[model samples]
Target: MRPFDPRLVRELPQTRAPVAALGLLGAAAGVAAIGQAFAIAWLVTALVGGGSLWAPAVTVATILAVRGILSATTEVTATWAGARVAGVLRERILGRWSRATADDRPAPERMLTISTHGASSVEPYVARYLPALVAAAVVPPLAIVTLLVVDWSSALIVVATVPLLPVFAALIGRHTQEATQRRWATQTRLAGHFLDVMRGLPTLVSYGRAEKQADQVAAVGDRHRIATVRTLKIAFLSSAALELLATISVAIVAVWTGMRLAWGNLDLQVALTAILLAPEAYWPIRRVGQEFHAAADGAEAIDALLADVPPACFAGRESMSVRDLSYRYPGANVDVLQGISYAVRPGLTVVTGPSGCGKTTLLELLAGLRTPTAGAAEVPRTHLVTQTPFVLPATVADNLALGTGASPAQIAAACAATGLDRVIAGLPDGTATLLGDNGFGLSAGQRARLGLTRAMLSDAAVVLLDEPTAHLDPASARQVRSVIRDLARTRPVVAVTHDPELAALADAQWPLTERVPA
Candidate 1:
């Protein structure tokens, strides 16, 4: 991996200013540090030569104070940069998923890991490693130039030794990067498995397979643990090796300067300054090496988050039309749908099929939530209500107004149309009532109505629903069916359902059959 990715600034322009600020601060700090070294050397020389010490003392004190303030500011800037970059990347990642077709996204669990854990890992990379990298770039060269001005022999020694740190760091970093990648993959797998177990816990328990799932989770956890330890081991070893190399390089410079001073070839002040500045040339590089290990996981996450995800393809048309549309899943050998043709019209169109006849997939395609493998679909702006509509934790009014920008009056009207207004009225806070995660405390019918109400608020030209009336009682089903029929009167409505009553209410019916072998 590169020490720093330029794409970070290109992809997230908001971070550019903060990153530039960091570079400036790092440069300023380097200047201050070098000044402190010179000031200390002057103070030592003044005391030894019986010269006035007040000026040198004050210079040392002032430079040290400036360095302290710069240190604090660097911390603050690094923190802000970390948060800003991580948050922006997370938002972009989620926004990409929101607009992409189903096939273009990663698995649910993998996406969950990326948006949360993966993006979060970038914080340390931005906060600590970046500043260290800047320091390594700005400080060492400045120190070497100063050394060259004072004593060319010392400067040559530093220049000769400085290259060794990065070369050794690169060799160790190769193994470190590999170890970190393995650990990251193992971590992703563990996170995916744990999420799967949680989602399927109820089913697993019912089938007496919960213990098996527990064992599987434990096994994955163990593998992740081992990978983590191995990565950390490499990180620790690399840090030690870099530190040892830096110490040895600095010691060599110090030894040469000491011999020059003893032989009366180098002045005492020059020797002291050389001793001080030699470490400056090596420590920043060491810091970068240490920070790189801490930021390795973040580097991997950045690569994944920036990977290309194809956008959904939908052509604008006057009306929705499917012409010989066919789709086969990514890895499937046979098509779930083939040679399907239809043009949606201004009425309810019920699509009926067996359990595995791609009925749900058909609605997804029409809604531009999936791309067809063969042929084309001309889809207009659409609102798709899946079998279990998404309901995040929020106020009733907020959930209803999500993405629609509907006013209070408009939201009330949409709720009334779907009979959700009654449900809202019975709540303690009415529209302001806060719902739990996944619309907890609301029944299936109520959640369904909430989804339909949202659809009612939308200005979509087409409405697609999956299993709208499934798992509802007779009274709730009647209310839902009435709302759906009322919606159909205004624009085109397509629903995938097994309900005979809903199918009977359709103005047209499209029945699908299982695909026969070619």
Candidate 2:
């Protein structure tokens, strides 16, 4: 990982102010610390000489108070900035995912881990590491410079030994970065597995595989525990090594100063100030090493977040068309689809195929959800209604109003068109009633109609539906098909289905067959 990535400032201009503020705070704190060190040295010299103590004691107290205030302000600023940066990163990751093509995005599970846990992990890096880094940069040089003027011998010892801290840190940091990456990868997989298990819990229980899933979760959790312990062990060992080195270096300086003072060659005030300034130069560098190891996971996350992401784009053509389109899964050698071509205009075009024949894949390609391996798909902005469309645990009106931002009248009209108006009228609060997660209160058929209702309200140039009539009863199927017909009147409508009745309503039909390897 870089000490500080310039991309952080280049891509996220909002973070620049926070980072600048942190730098300023760190510099101020460093100045205060150096002043306090001198003040304490003066007070000690006065007491040892039997001189008046009141003036030097008051000066030390005032400097200490200033140092305390600086410390508190740095923490407050770091915390607020850290939270804001993490929030912005999450927003950026999720926002980019929303506009990215299916092929351009990671799987749902990986995306979940990165956008949630991974984004949150960056907080420590911003809050602790950055401030520590600024301190290391600002304080060590200031302390060394002060020592240079007062006692060049102590300054030489400090300058020589301070380099060792970073050298040791770098050696340890290489290992730490590798360990952190492994731990983070394991964390991502563990999170993904848990998320998958939770999402499929009902299915597992129904199939009597819940016990097996529980065992798998336990195995993964154990692995994660082991990985975490290993990472922490490395961090602790490295921290201890740094502490020992700094302590020994300071001891050497103290020994040298004591020898000179015993011979009556060194003055009391100079000897005391040299002792005070020695630790100042070492502690900030050591703290930087400590915070660096601690924030390794966050460093990895920043790399992932700032990686280049290409946005999904669709052609601005009036009609959706595909020419010799072909596609394959990421690892598979054989193509899922090949040598296919079709056009969708302002009328209903139905796609028919048997199971595993790439019907849904074709629609996804046309909607810019997936990129084709060969040929091109020239399509306009499209709204795709997948099987089991997304529903939130929110007011029915709010869910319907998603994406389209339809007015109340438009929503009512769309609901009436899809036969959802009757369902809403029977509810306690009608459109204002809250539904359960993933439409718990609604039947499969109602949910299907709800998706179609969204499509009806959408103003997208093309509408793609996957099995729109699959979950509906005969009456509901007919009603939904009528709405589909009406929608096709204004824009291109493509539906993937086996319903012969719905297929009969199509103006044109395209049949697909599974492609076999040559």
- Find the candidate with the highest lDDT and give its number: 1
Candidate 2, residues 1-518, lDDT tens digits: the string is 88787787889988898889999999998998888888898999999899999999999999889888888988899988888888888888888888888899987777877888788888899999999999999999999999999999989999999999999999999999988888877888888899889999999999999999999989998898998999899989999999999999999999999999999989989998899889989999899899987688788888888776677888887788788999998998899898888877669999998989899989888888788999999998999999998899998888899899889999988999999999898888998899998897888888898999999999898999999999988899889989999999988899999999889999999899987777
Q: What is the TM-score of each candidate against the true structure?
A: 0.98, 0.96
Worst 10 residues of 1 by lDDT: 309-318
lDDT score, residue 8, model 1?
A: 89
Clashing pairs in 2: none
Tally clashes: model 1.
0
User: What shift in Å separates residue 497 of candidate 1 from its native position after superposition?
Assistant: 1.4
**Which pairs of residues have clashing backbones in candidate 1?**
none
Query: RMSD in angstroms, all models?
Result: 1.3, 1.7
Cα lDDT, model 2, residue 390: 89
**Judged by TM-score, which candidate is best?**
1
- Each candidate: what lDDT? 0.90, 0.89
